[model samples]
Target: MRLSNRNNKPLFSFIYSLVGIIFILGVIAYVLEISKFDVFGKKAWILLAIPSLLFLLLYILGRPVFEYDSDGEALNFRNNHILYILARKDAKDEFPKYKLLKFNIINVFVFKRLYVYILSKKNHIVILKYDINYLSKKQIKDLKFSLNKVVKANKEIRHEHEDNTVAV
Candidate 1:
């Protein structure tokens, strides 16, 4: 299935946390002004503002958009109108590409931010993340099976095609 930033909890948590922090800072500033405290100078103020500003910028830009098949055979990534497709086969199960260079999975968290990396023989690399990518225990197992199947099938096909003299 396709996944995007909409309805993602991590993005919401980030935005809300940033706003909350800024609000807390504002309260502290008001309190300091009320107390007439000069202990924290301009440098301290600048340091405090930097993180909030960066978080605001991130919130404005929004989260990255991601799209992938639930079965893990194909993927499409779109950012700023640049679409990248990382598919090794068509619907007919034919090898559209010569070889898949490498496929790696990196776990960022137990239930969030799963990383999938794809490299092709033509020097193409696709890095995808399932940010806030949560699934049930059963769904996770299914996804694992699908991913393993795709990787194994593609590797065997690539090796067989590279070695023509070997009999079927």
Candidate 2:
């Protein structure tokens, strides 16, 4: 899916911007606290340091963006960089689009708080997340439609295979 500018996210942008402002102020406070002046008290360290640490955590993991393609769904999980296909356990189809043919066309869907990565039969399976507020109303609906259609197809095809099951 197309991701607009990061600054367009209202709450996310506000929180990140607040974190930056707090961090800069915290640095200034630390310098003042250790300077030759008595402007900052011992309690200044606790006050500034505590919230700064908390907000730093928020700044790091609060917003995540995923890019999907035939290669794999890409994301930074923790400190590890990951890119791979996770086939669905329930779908027993062995062929599973054995080539990169499906990778050329990847679909993005929005469900509740999720960014569904509907990567056709060949690209394996993946899903994702991001705020819809960063997109227009039309974009949101289009994403939702794409995801729902793929999910429905997944159900029908999987069910058909199940009914034709054979014993080894």
Q: Where's the lowest-lDDT run of ten residues in candidate 2?
A: 78-87
> Tens digits of per-residue lDDT for model 1 on 1-168?
443343455664565566667757766775675468666655446544765676554444333333345334444432221112212222212122223333444444433444455664566775544432334455455555655666677789877877875764
lDDT tens digits, residue span 1-168, model 2: 333333344664566667678778777777777785556566568647766786655533323232222122332211111111211111111122221121122234522233334355555665433333334566546555544544565677666777878431
How accurate locally, in lDDT, is each candidate? 0.48, 0.42
**Cα displacement (Å) at residue 131, model 2:** 8.8
Query: Candidate 2: where is the Cα deviation over 4 Å?
Result: 1-18, 64-146, 165-168
Identify the candidate with maximal lDDT. 1
Query: What TM-score fits each model?
Result: 0.44, 0.42
* Best candidate according to TM-score: 1
- Alpha-carbon deviation at 78 in model 2, angstroms: 16
Clashing pairs in 2: 115-128
